[model samples]
Target: MQVSAGQAKLGADQITEAERGLLDFVTIEDGLGPQSSRRHEPDERTDQVRGRLDAVLIASRVAPLTRHIGLVPTVVATHTEPFHISKAIATLDYVSAGRAGLRVRISARPDEAAHFGRRTIRRTDAPDGGQPITELFDEAADYVEVVRRLWDSWEDDAEIRDAATGRFIDRDKLHYIDFEGRFFSVKGPSITPRPPQGQPLVTALAHQTVPYRLVARQADIGYVTPHDADQARAIVAEIRAEQQAAGRAGEPLHVFGDLVVLLDDSEAAARARLDRLDTLAGEPYNSDTRVFTGTAEQLADLLEELATGGLTGFRLRPAVTGHDLPRVTGDLVPELQRRRRFRTAYDATTLRGLLGLTRPANRYATTAA
Candidate 1:
């Protein structure tokens, strides 16, 4: 939200404070072009901040400013090249010293599609139904696949920089990744070598079976919106089934609940704040995800309850970033720590390490046994 208001420094300050608060990670969602509507089409409402800063660039800018906290920026896969994304994120990994990850998303808005002019997206490609939506998600899956393969195209030991031997790189370590899919085709090695973590974390937000399959097939983390614990449990179960069907049940995947929160010192104050915001915006607070209005302790209690439903963690969207983000980092985090439910110190340095994900082996590597 700070970035939306063109306050880049404030946004960086918030993230640094979040790191000091010991939060695991922060995701900067991009609105390359946006509509405030749920469909993501253009809307006439001008009350909200409509300006968008590129998510990756913002993360890269903030990389050297903070340490330990993971920087996960949103990148829309639609109309984007997998090779470019792979290079950008790989560079981000280097800039952040291995604390970078990305949440890959797909844009269906005709307005957003108009930006690249690569292809026209009809309104029929809506999120509700049709083969078009499935095709988009499938393409997104392929995009992730290509990005992953390209990350491994240059093996871990490809860069030798051996000036003594006049050899800067091991050419034999580079491998061609010939990937052909229904949506895209790419040949040869990526210009960027394997990232520090081998592969940075891949994530997506899944609401149904199609997107769930994408999450199962590729994502290291799946963000889900569930209104209640029962729904959370069911969603987790469904994603787990999809994982098994995708033949990736053996791999560890974290399912994180997504919530929109308006936090305060008291539950009443929180509700009042939400009501005020809604009144100013001239619309009731509405969202696809659950809305939480409560004290930090209450929010923490809710989180603990939801975690029992199989959610490994949560991604809370602050209704007002300036207010609620501070509440989350200062108040809610301490309450969780007091309950001995949260970490008082960062447990790991890298984003993958923080998430308990082991660094993946570069598939193209042929090391001696």
Candidate 2:
């Protein structure tokens, strides 16, 4: 489930009920967007809203309130340091008791770069001195690698807490990850202890070869947008091939389709609702994912059909949070259960276990072994 902070009324108390058994993971998008100029800022007279809430902070705030649902927040790799992100996510896992995951993202927008002013990103279409889009994906892969290393920097049993001897931690259990990369270098034995899940779940949305490669090499789960079963099959095959080439052929990697849904009791009603929303915005709503306007039954049917093409699950984007979210939780969930396609209850505590992924061994530990 994808929730937009700008649109959703996800107050702290409201989240507990909203995240009941219906959702295994609640995903929050990185809401960074173009900042408003003083002239362009909305006055009280206009209802337009602009500023975005940080994704990771929002997840952290809600982690204590919800227990079973995994809190996955988007972390942009473009200008952010991997070490800081690693510690923050590790802390989230501790707060949530291992129900934490990260949606790794990369920013290509020039306006986003201006906010940082640390590095200038070249436009993808620019002819000269511009960084290639491939480089961005490569850098993102490196970013995830460093973060994963930091998560494993302190072994699981590093903390001994031997008060009699006044020994707080086992120094021999701490390992330094000497990572040197083209984009950045990290020398680590993370200040944070190993997270509960060892390495918190890493996910990415891939729409092309470069990003698919990144997901294949790094992500535990990959979100893909496909229009039909054939497209889904092709994307899955490509990702599998890439995974095999990366020497992770036997690893468990989930491929989930991304869908935007506007559901009602009937198709016409759903269409009319979307039409009304488009009119209010003064344009048609366009999205990279397939947009479905139909009944909950129809949406469930589509998901099941797409699953045949090897998609393990879906990340649904509601057209309107207040209206569509309930439909997903109350209506669509039962519809999926009726078909015996969805889980009746959360069987696992950790996000990795919820997704049927085993906790990966610490890379440094395996190296030492």
Report the C-alpha lDDT of model 1 over 225-264, residue by residue, as the tens digit: 8888999999999999999999999999999988888888
Q: Relative to the true structure, how large is the alpha-carbon lDDT of every model?
A: 0.84, 0.82
lDDT of 1: 0.84
**Regions of model 2 farther than 4 Å from truth:** 1-14, 35-47, 125-127, 366-369
lDDT of 2 by residue, 1-369 (tens): 221111223445445645763576867776346333232222343445565688788889999888788888889898899999999999999999999999998887666667778656674647776567678899999999999999999988889999999999989889999999999888998999999999899999999888999999999989999999999999999999999999989998988898888989899999999999989877788888899999989988898788888888888877787777777878888787887877777788898888888898877764454
Off by over 4 Å in 1: 1-10, 122-131
Clashing residue pairs, backbone N/CA/C < 3 A, model 2: none
Weakest lDDT window of 10 consecutive positions for candidate 1:
1-10
